[model samples]
Target: MKRIAILNCLKANDVCAGAACLKAFNSRSRHFEQYGAEPIELVAMGRCNGCEVGIDEGFQEKLDRIIEEGAEVCHLGVCTIKSETRQECKTITEAANYLETHGVQIVRGTH
Candidate 1:
């Protein structure tokens, strides 16, 4: 089975339950359409380290856990890309780069 992880926006964590992203993945629709009939597993659901601290502080620990769980691909949730400022976008890019360096394929959107 294909192992997948989802990285969401930290700012939305309090208000969002991630139901939309999960629904899209489970139904193989929207951003998850490419999976089609393949057997896929949702291995991890994580968030950015927060705007103030960025991903530099403790993000690596979270990434390590995701990797340990066998996440082959990671999808950046919609909330992550709906950046209100350039800094947010840059942070998302940095997160994606970090994931790539660790050998995980990055998918830009979740739902």
Candidate 2:
């Protein structure tokens, strides 16, 4: 099975329960279509620190957990890519870079 992780926008966490992302992953639709019917394991789900701080505070711990879980790939949720501010965009970039540096492939969107 392919291990996967999902990173969402911190601000959106309050209202978004991630149903869409999970549905897409479970059905192998949208950005997850590449996986086809291959077995997939969702190893982690986390959110960015927030636009003000980006990925600065406590993000390493989260990343460590994700890596420890054996996630080979990370999908940045749609909320992350559609961030409302430039700072949020930067946070998403930093999160993606951090994941990549640790050997996880980055997928721009989850659904």
Best by lDDT: 1
Off by over 4 Å in 2: 83-88
Quote model 2's TM-score.
0.89
TM-score of each: 0.90, 0.89
Candidate 1, which ten residues in sequence have the lowest lDDT sum? 81-90
Q: Compared to the true structure, candidate 1 yields what TM-score? A: 0.90
Residue 27, model 2: lDDT of 91
Candidate 1 off by > 4 Å: 83-88
Q: Which tens-of-lDDT digit does each residue in 2-111 have in candidate 2?
A: 99999988878889999999999989999999998789999999887887876675886788888889999999887876545524387778778888999999998888
